[model samples]
Target chain A: MNSNGTTLRRIVLAGFVLLVTTGVRADGDASPIYGVRMPEGYRNWQLIAPAQEAAPLNELRAVLGNDIAMKAYRAGTLPFPDGSVLAKLAWKHVQSPEFEPASIPGAATTVQFMVKDSKKYAATGGWGFARFIDGKPADEAQHQTCLACHQARVKDHDLVFTRYAP
Target chain B: MNSNGTTLRRIVLAGFVLLVTTGVRADGDASPIYGVRMPEGYRNWQLIAPAQEAAPLNELRAVLGNDIAMKAYRAGTLPFPDGSVLAKLAWKHVQSPEFEPASIPGAATTVQFMVKDSKKYAATGGWGFARFIDGKPADEAQHQTCLACHQARVKDHDLVFTRYAP
Candidate 1:
């Protein structure tokens, strides 16, 4: 009985650690949208190296009934010197259930933003116009589609982007 | 001559300060894009606030052209301790040339993700399917006009969204 109890405790501890590490919370606070300023200056910052680990892993996992069709890219906060302003951006992706990455070659949407002094943010740029076709980084004018979609959330902060860090 | 030299020095100093404070550089390397993740002990984190600040901003600025289309908003970051991943989200109200908030709701095109993290992204989602009938966000999903337009950017980021902060 003692041995079993020990095993159960270990499992619980591991799960707690995992949760803490993942930062996977479904509840997010409701903040007014902010505007995105094209990468500006004088703000303290850091860039999260793009994650390639879960990319293919997700694809393979799909076959095992782990086919989570949605994925998101989120940027963290920038503390402006004024201390009153903060900024963030988040992008989400959902694949057509029938489409294959190898065959499709690109995303169907791109969302972005221009967040100003935290109070407001705007969807400044990113491609949000594409269906079956793929988009490339080399394509500039076409990439403007992202801003077109974000045009709806400008009043609050010029931000169509957001922060999940809390 | 002394007066002229002093003026020139002041101008140069102002320019330098602007560059540093704004995070802009003649070489264009200030904007950095970061990824989002969860901290330990969280179940599943998803965006909840600023329901609409998930798109780009610069492009909107160009299209709206000071029309008061939108502004910026509250911003912050989210992080997961284990993976060191962070996600950012913000919100904004996109307006029109009439200087009114976009009457449209939600994104017109689908937000895209790089397939399996292979440096490719596309707008496979239905975010681009809209029509501005009488200057409001109207659903244009029936037109199927978005896909053909997005086909050109297949090589860069796989039609996925990218942040051009430079």
Candidate 2:
């Protein structure tokens, strides 16, 4: 996800997140998926950081890491290993009426991933990307922009925006 | 965790969280562990809610659910099943210079848990509790306070501070 996402980007992400929870698949849209499939059991990963997307998307986000990704984070290794993967789970940010001065997740928005494959995704900083709702991949147009935003902003952090919060 | 914690409580929790990371085991303090050991593979569980502790603790928290716990959450079942388990992972809350108005995880603080087993823990609700650092359990005195705070605050919600945000 873009750290400084444009209004157009947020709008597109908002639409994708909304449609995904409804189980509305774009199966007929035969475009290249960039070979980025949702990782199995991504939900079980440990958190890397917490984020709040500015308005438009207005999502509460948590970035999680696979074991390999976590190891690299703990070791402070630059250029994460090939097996490393990161998952970004997002939800509609809502005020917690039950808890004062706190925000809680409302509806789930998107579950995005960045998979490292030095040999495969070499053209895009060794990371393959995917954005999904209900495990249904977003259109290719969305995938195409992943690296551009990440590279433009946090290319120094191995093309990743999240730091190991813990 | 208390939704409206007192300053004293935050101070105590802060001390415990800070010390745990240093590997300062309280092995000399022989007190009943309440038969609540840290659950295995807890890092792989799905999220329940995100929390931010006030002032003294100044922590970012994410509560996660095991398979049984998640099933009950999604089905809106009251009094979670006997096998259900919840894990609360907390870290020092820090600002992200990389992204504006965003707070990220800093150093890890504590990993706490609530396990539901009505028959075994019928004396003080159906929950068993523990707080740990590097998988080492907190002192028994700390364990004793878990249910008291939770039951006092959120008894209606299965004695849990977290609600399924997604």
Candidate 3:
């Protein structure tokens, strides 16, 4: 074989090794909607809102969105445009003794994402929901409930609960 | 005066002094919208969005809203409900050499608020806007332009721009 061909074969072998070691795949390729890979730079996205839930789910949540989502929000577009993505980061809510009555974040609980692709997630209201606990994909049972809850509660709003704070 | 009445007067006087020294005032009591006091525990509010502007106006912005605003957002309500307050904190955006391609906050530029009160700010589309630089209210002329800009560009969005990223 030619020297160039040998070099090409080596590059291909190295690429395969890297992929196997990292265990990363394109979003949605690994586990349908439940295991969508976390989007790059999601932490820097636009903030949609913050939330605090009580009782069984005592957590503080922050919702953020990508540029596509922000554009739809600014335009007041409904059903969100394709390519829109949202991330939710939650932490255990705790009281701050120094600043009485003020709540502060304790430990991080989960990081989740809701990706939109009309064609890919058409069966699930054009949105794919995912939750990662400690950076690991949540169980299948937990993922199944995501679609059901959104469909039942916020079907009219494109299966989304957040609105543009604008 | 009786002893009890004298003690009561002293307490009232002390309370007034505390308020003045802290530079805190009830919203709208000071200088129209320019001197509206910063709300307590605002940093804990839900983040509505993050922004980066370039050139003549280089800054990083974080938009946060109180519970009332978050509720309205989740429900997809328009005109945000009464008592929905949003704060925008901005800082000079600077590049961190240690973390290339990442931006870090430098000096804080301003903290601003958009307070909603249909009856109180009826002339300004039910929202009052205020900006403080270095903890001091911006000039009245600069404050006046805030409403005008929002009114002209995002009037349909209740004169606001940030959206909930659910």
Top DockQ prediction, candidate number: 2
**Most lDDT-accurate candidate:** 2
What's the true lDDT of residue B36 in model 1?
A: 13
List ranges where model 3 is wrong by over 4 Å.
A1-35, B1-166
Q: Higher TM-score: candidate 2 or 3? A: 2
- Assess the local accuracy of residue A127 in candidate 3 as a C-alpha lDDT between 0 and 100: 88
Angstrom error at residue A81, model 2:
3.2
Residue A136, candidate 1: Cα error in Å is 38
Tell me the lDDT of candidate 1.
Answer: 0.26
Query: What does fnat come to for each candidate?
Result: 0.00, 0.36, 0.01
* Candidate 2 wrong stretches, greater than 4 Å: A1-35, A54-57, A67-78, A133-145, B1-41, B44-46, B53-58, B67-77, B131-149
| Chain B structural similarity as TM-score, candidate 3 | 0.83
TM-score of chain B of each: 0.21, 0.78, 0.83
- Candidate 2 docking band: acceptable
The collision pairs in model 2 are: A44-B44, A165-B105
Instruction: Please give the TM-score that candidate 1 achieves against the real structure.
Output: 0.19
- Candidate 2 on B101-126: residue-level lDDT in tens? 66677889888878888998898799
lDDT of 1 by residue, A1-166 (tens): 9999999999989888855643223232221222122222211122211111123222100000000101122322223211222222222323323322211112222222222222222122321221111111224444445455446654343332332211
Candidate 1 Cα deviation (angstroms), residue A2: 48
